[model samples]
Target: MRRVFMIGGAITKFGKHTERNLKSLAAEAISGALADADVAKEALQGVWVGNAAQGVLTGQESVRGQVVLRALGIGGIPVVNVENACASSATALYGAGALVALGEMDVALVVGMEKMYLDDRTRVLSAFSGCMDVEALPELTRNFANQQERVKKGMQRGGAKKKKSRERSIFMDFYASLALEHMEKYKSTQRQLAVIASKNHYHSTMNPLAQYQNSLTIEEVLEAPEVVWPFTTPMCSPIGDGAAAMVICSDEYARRIGARHSVEVAACMIASGEDRSKITESTLSRLAKKAYERAGVGPEDIDLAELHDATAFGELYSTEELGFCPLGEGGVFAEAGHSTLGGKLPINVSGGLESQGHPIGATGVRQLVELYWHLTGRAGRRQVQGAKVGLAQNNGGSIEGAEGALSVTILKA
Candidate 1:
């Protein structure tokens, strides 16, 4: 495949845009990206749009790409719609990159947009449930019974104050189970999870596009309202509305257009989750291994990253799976400050999903936008100095006991 270059990208502020629709958000991001790339809509050879739950949330079903882009006077191109749960936009990016790499198109636009902040919160939450296997939900949730009891006992022993559980995303329970398992097996503490949350909150203060800019102390995070045993409200990502867009082109196109700040897509790989009982490398680990090998780099060579921290535990677990730290020692790694700014390798400098906001479809593309800024020395305050190599890990949905779909993208300056 030919080399792909990301010439430009942009993201809207991530927050509860209750008044906005998908088209408004997409237009803003797409306009910003086009301006950044110094290209016009006419230059886009094809368009790929990533959105999940749009049909369920807003009743906008198929032809999402054509519907959104057409309103902006962009039409008559091959518009592909992608829905891969949370990895929708990343999958869209992968598609655009592939076509560009294969000489099918020189320039392509990838847009990820989601409008999830609605008055009917139940409907919003239910959209998340749709990402999983509905047929097996009965059996899957039944399995939660035993794990819930085990988690409760463990939390009680750890002296965790019980907070009444409210209606929240089912993913929280999954993360809670993972946290409990990690704690039981590795002796990691809930306080370590709080530390990760606190760090991301602090990092969000530097990200103007982040949904929550207020930094929470570790103590504050620990004392906040609990979503699950070890996860406080601040430790989980909020439902939000946002959009992110990117302008990808072939290396030749970049040179021909005099693109001065293009970031090379060294490697991008997508993998589906396997049976948890297999006991081999997890989905993310296997994907990351392929990405690193294809990029001719290792975890240590990465300067910064934007991980899918749907929950603080998600970040902790990902740090281990991506080989950023030794297996089962993610808590220890964060406690040592290795994953914070100016440390060995900063992770989630954009505040991650916890603070930066996970707009589902937008998150995958938003990650690359953050990394592109840092790679080009444009990240205002949270910039990792001298950042050259960056990685982004985004996963969506859930299978038997793993992420339904996972993607890893490596970028180099």
Candidate 2:
């Protein structure tokens, strides 16, 4: 099979773009990617777009790619729209890689975009439809009410109750429960998790496209207002608008296309939770092992990484499961500075979804943009010296146990 290579990639600064519509953001990213690849628009054979919440955010449906591409005067070529929740863009790049490897296309443009700050916060959040079973939603809401009732009783013993906004961000409750359970089992503290958020904030200071570019000390991060029990507001991924894109093609095709830099795609892993327990710890275990086998490289071989951190605990548990740190050791690994700049293996130098803003559909592709810069020594202040390989872990869904959708990609310079 032909090896797929990323010729170039780009991402727009992630932030709230209440004024800009979805297509404008998409065009900005695609135009930048095309210029980076040094390829004419007509040379592209196909396009793949990743979007998670356009339907709820913009009332747009399957026509996302068509409309977005049309804004750039590049349309009529085959366009594919991908929606895998937060893994949307990862699947987009993986699909582009597959097409190039299978000889289906000589060149492909993969774009991931989301304009999440469009509707009111409450309305836009309803896009989390994948996390629930529609058939039992009525009962699930009832269960939630009952669960809250139980929580109220438990809190009453301490004269406490949940705020209305607390109930608004119900998914945080799920994530908080996971974090609480992990802490109970591991003796992890809020300070340890705050380090992950703090490090990413500092890392973003070097990232021009990052939303949170200001530096923050661990003390400042830990002192921020708590979003949940252990999570502060700054410890969570921001909601914003942005686009990320990469031009990928076969190695021979890349040389023919004459792009400046090229990175090989060694392994791409996609896993579904078909037969698993809720919060199963097996996704990372099984997927990372398979990825290592396919790429012939282990976690220790990675120079840097970009893992999902929709919340602080994401990095905490995911790093452990990916074997970068032993079980219950991710907090220690993070607080030790191993996951920060100048560390053994830096993670989320694009500031991650936490600081870069989680434009769900655009996030996975942005991870590649971060890796592209790192492997090519273009990450500026966030660059890891002597870096030769990079990895990204993008997961989504909140059913049963842990994250439901898992996608892992390993890249080599």
Candidate 3:
């Protein structure tokens, strides 16, 4: 198999873009990526577009890739539409890399875009409900109710108030439940979660394209309105609209074009969550192990990471699962400053989803764009010193006990 290299990557400022449509957002990112790669639109051999909720959100269902690419004056290419929930764009990158590695395509364009901010906030929240199995939503709701009851009981016992809000998605409840479990099993504190959120917010201040670019203290994060117990509004990723794109090509094409500062795709591993009844390895752990084996690197070798921190707990849990630290020590790891810039292994120097803004389908691709900038010494203020190996973990959708789709991509400078 030929090696795959990312020649260019670009992302729009991730925030609530009420003026942009799907095609316009995609075109902006695609144009930026093409310019960055120094590759003309005519040189692209294939196109992969990642989007999750355009059909429900915008009523544009089929031929999304075709429509978007055609609007950019690119046509007759193998346009593939990918929808893997939040990992949509990352999975598109994985597929594009595979095509290039197999020598089927010399150059491929991967774009992930989503327009999530609609006039109706409830409609926006309802769109996320599609990430789960719709048929099983009743059961899931029951489970959520039970979890809420448990949380209420725990709060009552501790003399804490039960904050209420119907504004957020069910994912927060899921995250809160997972956090409670972590707290119960490992004695992790809400303060630690706040620390992680605050760190990401601080990182965002250095990121011009981040949705929330204000620095947040740990106290502010903890004092913010509670979305779920232990999770302040600052701990969660906001609903946003954005797009990210990248140009990936084979090794020969990279050298032929004299691609400057091209980052090598060491490994792109995609996996599905399994039905595991025990507290053993998670899908992310299994995928990360495979990625390390394929890339001939380990967590110790990874200098930085862009993780799917849709919530602060997501980062904490992923740090442990990715072998950055020992199991159940993610909170401790964050509290010790190991995951911050200039720390041992800086994770989410791009502010992560918590502050960078998670645009569902675009988020995974955005993570890679951040890693590409970091690996190529392009991340200005939030750059990690001496970052050589970078990892991106993007997971999408929720099943009974795991993510429906997960992608782990490792890159080298």
2 in model 1: Cα distance from truth in Å?
A: 1.4
Q: Per-residue lDDT for 213 in model 2? A: 92
Alpha-carbon RMSD of each model: 1.3, 2.8, 1.4
TM-score, candidate number 1: 0.98
Q: What is the lDDT of candidate 3?
A: 0.91
For candidate 2, give the lDDT.
0.83
Ranking by lDDT: 1, 3, 2
Please give the clash total of every predicted structure, in order.
Answer: 0, 4, 0
Model 1 misplacement above 4 A: 157-161
lDDT of 1 at 233: 93
Residue-level lDDT of model 1, residues 1-413, one tens digit each, is 78999999999999999788888999999999999999899989999999998999888999988988989999988999999999999999888889999999999999999999988989999899898888877787777767877766654534655575468888887788778878889998989999999999999999999999999999999888878677889999999999999999999999999996899999989988888888677778988999999999999999999999999999999999999998889989899999999889899999999999999999999999999999999999998999999999999999776789999999999
Error of 1 at 112 (Å): 0.8
What does the lDDT read for residue 336 in candidate 3?
96
Candidate 2 Cα misplacement greater than 4 A, ranges: 129-131, 135-168, 274-281
What is the lDDT of every predicted structure here?
0.92, 0.83, 0.91
Range of the 10 consecutive residues with the lowest summed lDDT in candidate 1? 153-162
Candidate 2 lDDT for residue 394: 90
